[model samples]
Structure formats: C-alpha cells, structure tokens
Target: MQKEIQIAQLITALQKGDVTAFDQLYFEYAPLLYNRIFKLIKSPEIVEEILQEVFLKVWNMRAQLEVDRGLKTLLCRIADNLAIDHFRKASRDRALQEELWTSSVGFYLHTEESIFDKEKQRILNEAIQLLSPKRKEILTLCNIENKSYKEVASMLGISANTVSNLLVSAMKDIKNYIHSKYEGA
Candidate 1:
C-alpha cells in the first residue's frame, strides 16, 4: 500500500513534468525493463537502445499518460512493442538480404556465360523506374540501401506496415516486369 502511494505520487509528479520523478522512475524500473527487453532482443546494445527509446517516448508523451493504469504495465507494454518491432525489422532485413544475395549471385553466374550484365542491369533499372514514386522510394530504401521497414516508414512518414506492403508489391511488379521482358529472350 505504501509502495502504491509512492508510485502514485511519482506518476503525479511525472505528469507535471518532474525530471526528478522521471529519474526516480527510471532508476526503479530500468533494470527490470532492460532484463525483459534483453530476453527478447538478445543483444545488450540493442536492448540499451530500445530502453532509451522507450523512456524517451515516455518523457515526450508524459502529458498524455494515464496514472490510473499501473506504470510498470505501461512501461512493459512499450518495451514489448519496441522489442517486437526490432525482431520484425531484423527478420525482414535478413530475408531481404538473402533474397537480394541469391538473385545477385544467379545474375552474376549467368553473366559469366554471356555479356548480358549491362543489359540486365538496364532492364532492372527500367523495371524499378516503372514503379510509383512511393514504391520506388520503398524499394530503394529497403532493397538498395538495405534499410529496415521501420526506418523507411519513419523516413517517409508512413506506417511500417505500409512500407512492408508497398515493398512486397514493388518487388512482385519488378520481378514480373523482368521475367516478361527477359525470360523468353
């Protein structure tokens, strides 16, 4: 009961933009949060980065925070969401890298037997240019620049899911364009 009152008082102070209260809260919860995040991320550097982002978000959105809910629960939810976001991004990046590598390797091997590398590159460029501007941007960031969906989404002021969907569509279109143009020739 006493601890609850302390937590309530901390929340009230935090909502009022009290840095000391924020620090106190961080000190009280960061370790537990770090452990939870580390279990999901499995990298100390990434865990630290996520923890910082989570607290920064909390501080930035303090005015909208609801003290009625348990602070620990709120923090844990934020941490979990961030960790899941990281996992999704890592997974997407790995898959994209593998696909790009595989395609590049096949193209390289095929080019060794023929002098069609330049033509193939041109065709790929043309196929990319056929996409919508936003889709082009997604492909550039995600495939060319090797950025994560979240990074691309943040850069484009869209949701990560939007970035993902656009990338899938763009990749499919590019593949179809290339196949139709080059398959029978």
Candidate 2:
C-alpha cells in the first residue's frame, strides 16, 4: 500500500517534469522491465535497447501518464510492443536474425536461474536432432533462422508447399518428443 502511494507520488511529480522523480521511478522499475524484455527477446543487446526506448517513451509522453492505469502496465505494454517490432524486423533481415540467435546463449548466462532454462534448451536441441536432416534444416531455417517460406523455399530449391509440409511435420515430431519426455514427470 505504501509503495503504491509512493509510486503515485512519483508519477505525479514526473508529470510536473521532476527529473529526480523520474530517476527514482526508473531505478525502481528498470530491473523488472529488463528481465521481462530479456525473456521475450532472448538477446541482451536488444533487451537493453528496448529498455532505454521504453523509458524514453515514458519521458516523452509524461504529460499523458495516468496513475490510474499504472506505470508498470504502461512500461510492460511498451516493452512488449517493441519486442514484437524487433521480431518483425528480424524476420525480414537475415543477418539480424542470425546475430540474435548466436548471441542468445550468452544472455542466458546472465541470469541466476538459467539452469532450468538450459535443461529446456537441451531437450529442445535433442528433439531437433532427432528429426531427419532435411526436416531439421527446414525447421531451423524457417523458425530459428527466421526466414520466410518463400526465402527458405528458394534457398532449398523446393516448392513453398513442400517447405510448409516439412515444417508442419517437423513441428509435430518435436512436440511429440517433448510431450513423451515430460509426460510422466
């Protein structure tokens, strides 16, 4: 209750252009926002970029801040939208997609509770490995590599329909493998 009161006070001060109040709010909420973004983006660099953008937006739109809507809600919606935009951009840019995937593993180490995450990653890796080579390649290209159906079809010299079919089959295989592994647990 007291924290809520303090947050409301800070928001009111921030509306009046108080830099100290803004700093206090940022300090209190940045970690929570950062963690939320990292979970969605899985890339430290992009997460940091989005975190800064979230605050910049808050500051730029300070006049519109509504304490009733809650600052955390506003920050989260901004971060989620930015993360979705990043994915959309990445889908069109092969280089960015590759960079994000390559750097993802490093970011997991930054979190203390990554042991369970690592195990899940291992299981997913195993499931992918169990797929046929061609199916595995298609899944990696279309999903992990963030390639469009047309681009992947062109690269593989296969029809878009074939690519789609293989992708669906591969996904089912992965799903079944994961389900079987965890069914009894």
Candidate 3:
C-alpha cells in the first residue's frame, strides 16, 4: 500500500536537504506519529520535543536511508524509539525503573556496562545502532529497562498490537543485518 516510487523520490530529496520534500514527509507522517506517541506520553510538551527529535534524526540520517521497505515504516520505527528514550530518561531516577528496564531488554549484559570492551562493545553497538529504532527500543525496554510489552505500550500510548508488530519487524531486520555480516566463512 506504500507509494514506493514517491517514497524513494522523497528519500532522495530528503538526502539533498530539500525543504519541500522534508515538509511533505513531515506533514504526512507527523500526525500519525504524534497520535501514536501522545497516546502514551500524554504530554504535549515532551511529545513535541520527542517528535521533533524523531524527524531531526531522520533528516540527519537521511543520507543512509533506504526506502525499499517504505519510508513510513522507517519513520514509525524512529518514533517508536524516541518514545522509549523519552521514557527511559524521564524515569531515570524512579524506584522501579530498573525493574522496568530489565523487563524490556534482553540478557545482553557484557562484562560491564562500559563499552570499554573495545572490539566487542563496538560490534555490539554497531548491531544495536543498525536495529530499526523499534527493535532497539524493544530491546531497551524489555532487557535494559525490564518492562513488559503491556507496560511499554502503556508508556507510549500505543496498543500492544502495534508494539508487537513493530518489535517483530525490528527483530527480523536485526537478524538480517547481523546474519549478512556474520554468515561468510
């Protein structure tokens, strides 16, 4: 259902810093993002900030953007991530925060929380960074924050259905990204 050619054109335009292209995509997608996001945060103040951050991140990374999968999905993934980060930073000092983190992240702890493990940490960070924002957020929430999908969706104002859909897509992308890099003998 995605307009593939239009999206590819938009991605190309966005990469060139085309204002019209940016405005076109932003106007079209920001509402869906805001609605999906505000359902959880419910704060116009933080929601606006995170929304801006999501678009900005998209523009910043536009050079690397690919639309074979549709730009809307990528934007959705970005929105999902910023929402999680907003929640993480917001609850950084809450009493039950660790419990929340553990539930959201996987058992991905290395020797320490520090990326000082150099090679290993770099590879790990690359993998994390390559994840569609949704997967990274899901991994963050379930493993790092220890949150359940129910809780994560509640915080983001999204249905568990949406969260599950995005998480599944993210996991598949991560697997493919990692597999392509590691598969060669």
Candidate 4:
C-alpha cells in the first residue's frame, strides 16, 4: 500500500523553499536516486550533476504535480530518463573521435566457418562476460535483438545517440577481447 503523505508531497514542500521538507526529501530519496544514476552512468561527478538537476527539475515543476501512486516510480523514471540523456550527450561527444579514426578502422572477413555452434557459443560467452553490464545491455538491445537505435534508446530510456555511443564502445571492447583471446589459437 502507498503512503498517503508521500515523498512527492515532501518534494512539493521543498520546492516551496521549506528547508525542513527539503532535508527530509533528500534523506528519503537521494541515495536511491544516486545509485540508480550511478549504475547507468558510472561517474560520480556526472551522477552528482544529474542528482542536482533532478531535484531542480522536481522543484521547478512541483506546482503542476498530481500523484495517484507511490513517489518511488515517479522519481525513478525522472532520474533514469535524465541520466540516460546525460550519458547520451557524453556518448555523442565521444563519437567525433571515432569518426576521425574511421579511415583506420578495418573489417575482417572470416574464412573459417568450420566452428560448431557450441564452440561459437563459448567464445560469445567469453565476450559477453568481458563486458560491463551496461555495455552488454547496449549490445543485447541493439545488435543481437536487431533493434533500431531509437528503439533501443526507448527501451533503455535514453537517447538514440546514447545508444549509438554505448553500442560503439561495446563493440570496440568485444573486438579487442576476441582478438586477444583467439588471435593465435
């Protein structure tokens, strides 16, 4: 059951410059929001910025609020959407570097198709294990499942550019891992 006097109400009070309410709201929700942002973005600095922005947004929009449910879901959605936006923007910034190295990028053709599904699965597992969960999620959502960038972004609650960035990073890591493991074997 949901509490009648919810944290959103506390947030509304905080938005009105109620210091005690703000402190109460922070104590209640900040840690959960922080971890949610951190797991996705993986940067304390960026997470701090996102956390501040989230509170600011809540405060700025508090006047128009209506809550028929628990504050947890609403707050989680806001933090998640915002963190995805931040990471997506950062990912786009990193893409210029990839474009510069485009000429240096090479594609390899596999001549040996003799490996059975079991062996292929083993190598694939190793590759997946080498990735951080975020990267693995990016690949699973976009590549293996054949979702469009926008689709993956929506599913992950981020921007298309962020999806692109995560996909790029994940691919690079997987390629390097596979090479080091199978190059001379």
Best by TM-score: 1
RMSD of 1: 24.8
Give a tens-digit lDDT track for model 4, residues 35-59.
Answer: 9999988889989999998877767
Cα lDDT tens digits, model 3, 21-80, are 999989889999999889988999888998999899988987888767567788888888
Worst 10 residues of 2 by lDDT: 105-114
The runs of at least 3 residues in candidate 3 whose Cα sits more than 4 Å from the true structure, single-residue gaps closed, are: 95-185
Candidate 1 yields a Cα-based lDDT of 0.93
The better candidate by lDDT, 2 or 4, is: 2
Rank order (by lDDT, best first): 1, 2, 3, 4
The C-alpha lDDT values of all candidates are 0.93, 0.91, 0.80, 0.78
Better of 2 and 4 by TM-score: 2
Clashes of 4: 0
Please list the Cα RMSD from the true structure of every candidate, rounded to 1 decimal place: 24.8, 23.5, 33.3, 27.9
- Greater TM-score among 1 and 2 belongs to 1
Identify the runs in model 2 with alpha carbons over 4 angstroms from their true place.
95-185
- Model 1 error, position 104 (Å): 1.1
Better of 2 and 3 by lDDT: 2
**Candidate 4: how large is its RMSD?**
27.9
